[model samples]
Structure formats: structure tokens, C-alpha cells
Target: MLFCDPSMLPCYRSVQCIGYLSVKIHRFMLYTFTFIYSLGV
Candidate 1:
């Protein structure tokens, strides 16, 4: 789901900037959502 989920655009972009590097797609998405949720954003 690399940048495919519109609702996750901001989170995805933020994660990208943080540098996922060569991480797996599912792992990246999971990390992004967890990070966002933790921020209560």
C-alpha cells in the first residue's frame, strides 16, 4: 500500500521523510499508523 491509501497520505509522507529506506510495505504502513495513533493526530 505504498502511498495508495489516500487517508494515510500525510502519515505515509511523514514516514517517508523519516526514512523507511528498504523496509517492507506492510511494516512501513503499520509503523506509520502506530506512530500517528500514538500522537492522537
Candidate 2:
């Protein structure tokens, strides 16, 4: 809906995908760090 124009749809979708992947990667990194710290402790 925000990108109603056809020309903008691809750009909007790509941005959305990138945002989602970044969030997932960030969470994964956080969890990995926490797990490693716990093991070290």
C-alpha cells in the first residue's frame, strides 16, 4: 500500500526484504554472543 505505484514496488519489496534479513541477522548475532559468554562463565 505504501508503494502503490508499479515502478516503486520492486524497490519497496527489496527494501522490505533487506530490513527483514538484517533484523534476523542481528538477533542471531546477539544470541550467539550471549551463548558464548555463558559458556565462558
Candidate 3:
């Protein structure tokens, strides 16, 4: 069971968080991942 179903774009829209909020959040996650990767290397 998934507690947070972030796979659906409409999820954020349903909450009135705007259309691109998911994309922005995805970008932030990628950036943070890269930062942590570089720090570990």
C-alpha cells in the first residue's frame, strides 16, 4: 500500500497546488539527489 501516491499529476491539481507544482518538486528532488551524490563521491 502506498501512503503517498505521487505518481499522478492530478493529485496536486486536486489539492489546488497548480499544474507545475509536481514538475517543480520532481526537479528539486533530482537536484537534491545530485548534490548528495557529489558529496558522497
After the best TM-score superposition of candidate 3, give how far the Cα of residue 32 lies from its true spot, in angstroms.
0.2
- On residues 1-41, what C-alpha lDDT tens digit does candidate 2 reach at each position? 33334555688877876777788899999999999999999
lDDT of 1 by residue, 1-41 (tens): 44434466687767764554446666888999999999996
Ranking by lDDT: 2, 1, 3
Where's the lowest-lDDT run of ten residues in candidate 1? 1-10
- CA-RMSD of model 2: 5.0
Top lDDT hit: 2
- Model 3 shows how many backbone clashes? 0
**TM-score, per-candidate, Cα-based:** 0.42, 0.75, 0.54
**After superposition, which runs of candidate 1 have C-alpha atoms over 4 Å from their true positions?**
1-23
Off by over 4 Å in 2: 1-8
Q: After superposition, how far is residue 17 of candidate 3 from its true place, in Å?
A: 4.7
Steric clashes per prediction: 0, 0, 0
Pairwise lDDT winner, candidates 1 and 2: 2
lDDT string, candidate 3, 1-41, tens digits: 12234665666545545435676789899999999999999
